[model samples]
Target: MQRIALLFLILGLNCIAAGAAEHSTACGSMQLAYYELGTLYYRHADGSYTGIDKDVVEEVAKRSGCKFDTVLESRVRIWTQLKNNTLDMSVSGIPTPEREKFAEFIPYFSTRNYILLHRDMPVHGLSMAGFLNDANLKVAVIKSFKHGPKFDEWLEKLWAQKRVYEASDIDSLLRLFLARRVDAIIALPTVWQPLLKKEEINKQVHLFDWAPQDSIVHGLIVSKERVSKARRDLLRKAIYSMADDGTLEQIFTRHMGSKLAQELRYDGPRF
Candidate 1:
């Protein structure tokens, strides 16, 4: 009785609000995968996962009385599996119309996507367009990432102009930029800055005047085909409860500080 009460309190709901599923039921048996966001869910030497997103997911599970067999996989595989109904949930996803067809979202936080300029460029006040138009300079992006509709259109023009360098993931993109192989990179500091080792490089990089997507969000995306509507609603309510109780704020602020949290506009379920 005491343990159930504690869970209910943490979840910000009475268990009676939504009849609890058994520990071995469909939603409880679902598989969860964490995308390879370095700080978000990197494997420790001991093979355990820990990060802001992981913490949020753990709390949601406790509140909703759900359990998952967690795995770490590539973002591409995670999405493919979710579409094919082979995977149950992913904690790191940016919602899009295409994704909406396959997954139901419970957005927990937002992120900023900005262009990083190599400080060696003698020009000040250079914008993303100016950098892209310069034939000698190359811009880096993760292949097939939708930085937002506008950015995607601009990237198409880049393809015709032969000014784009494609990387398979953020790690490779960062390497190409840091090695002086690319003049600029489009990325999120919230996700990339923590992976950087050299404080000097961070100082050396400057933000381009144009932000491609200033307010792209990150969230839990559960498979619409695999999880029932009831389960999805239960999870969504649990996530919103965390935000309402300021648990989401604490988790993000601990990793990103108050300023970035405010700047990125950490929010829940705008959809």
Candidate 2:
């Protein structure tokens, strides 16, 4: 009986070792893309990156014991590369049908769409219909962003009437809005709040939530073509752990504040 028990213990230890090796081999190294979107990601003068997204990514890497080769890219290009499997991972991703076919999203935060208008713009009841009826109110949007279904519907209507301006990236969109080239821009409170820093600029901006009932979940995106099911499961577990342990809330609070952080804290079913 003693001999038999020893044999079982040795086998169990070997199985654990094998499992650890497999995990390491599966996610030992990966490619990650980052983009500038409000307080999510930004570059520093010393050629380093920081912000909520960066902090989250680093924490994930630490937990998973995976080394990430980070690259800077536009949101549009990030999606394209994710579809092509040329990228392994990216932050602040909201899944779509086409993207679901090529990537798996592990949600970490939640946000809703808001329309930031200049205070001097014509008062229009703060409704989509009011804004849509006013042909003079032109809005700018980032190229490949998903600002929720309602915003997309309004944007489509606006585009049909040539009342929309498209920007290549967030910085350009902010410039267009600040330069008075556009009447308003679609953004999340967490996104626009940090970008519009000047007190005078803040005074000129008025934010209205167009989709108060809708909350969009955003998080780490892993490419299906490049990542195996084993790795995806591992990553999902790591992200879920972060969400459960207050790590995610800590990161959000550090960058955006306790109130906004609590608002963004994701407490939904894991996908």
Candidate 3:
């Protein structure tokens, strides 16, 4: 009878394992949107995606026992599709009240934005207000990117003065900046480090932290319409678990160095 009981217990554990596997499979594959943002997510020569964001998503899927299908899209389009319920998930998203209505955000990382300028530009020590007042100096920015309220306000004023260039995406923005089409552009370290690795590009560009107090938390955003509440919570919990386990920091550290990784993980005054 004891042997029989042991056999029954073994069978019960096996059944539990099978049930968990089935549940994981039942979760289905989610559509994850990625964009070309520095070391966050980008395509490679082999036509594959790899970066800090990609690693985070992959690890979350592993912990949650879910699958994800990632596709490339611009930051603007990613938000639009999330609102339309056409996209299931995305990483590196900043949460706002409007976005929170259509999606649930899981905060994982923090970073600040800066004004990248040509090394030769005479805008050193100039505040954002001063930069704005210089009518001859034109600026470019990635469309639909939020660089804190002050930077956004400066952009608005620049726009009103017809001194702003709106690039559809990061690559185009970098090109415009590099080609000297725009006098300055706003970028985060994660978005510029990988793209500006070339010696010449590095020499041509410099950054001004217009708003030192402006830090923003970014993370996974799940569509409330397409993803069930339970599933969304599951993903969020997985990400939080990753943060607790130091997986998120390690991923960022692997892509960027330790200094920037620490800042991205716990910068002061997060927006």
Give lDDT per model, in order: 0.75, 0.85, 0.83
Report the lDDT tens digits of candidate 3 across residue range 1-271: 9999999999999999998988788678999988877898877899887899889888988888789997888788899899988999998998889999999888888888888888887744256776776778998888877888778777888888899889997879988988889988888889877756878888887767888888787878989889998787778778778877888889989999898888888432322
Residue-level lDDT of model 2, residues 1-271, one tens digit each, is 9999999999999999998877666678889999887789876789777899989888887777677899888888888898887899999899888889999899999988888888887767367899899878889987777888778888999999999888997778889998999989988866777866768678888888788877888978999889888777878888899988999999999888898899898878876
Q: What number of clashing residue pairs does each candidate have, in the order they appear?
A: 0, 0, 0
lDDT of 1 by residue, 172-242 (tens): 99889889898878876565657444686677787653654456777799998899998887788788888
RMSD of each: 5.9, 3.0, 2.5
Scored by lDDT, the top model is: 2
Question: For every model shown, what is its TM-score relative to the native structure?
Answer: 0.83, 0.88, 0.90
In model 1, how large is the Cα lDDT of residue 88? 91
Q: Answer with 2 or 3, whichever has the higher lDDT.
A: 2
Q: Which 10-residue span in candidate 2 carries the lowest summed lDDT?
A: 119-128
Compare the candidates by TM-score and give the number of the best one.
Answer: 3
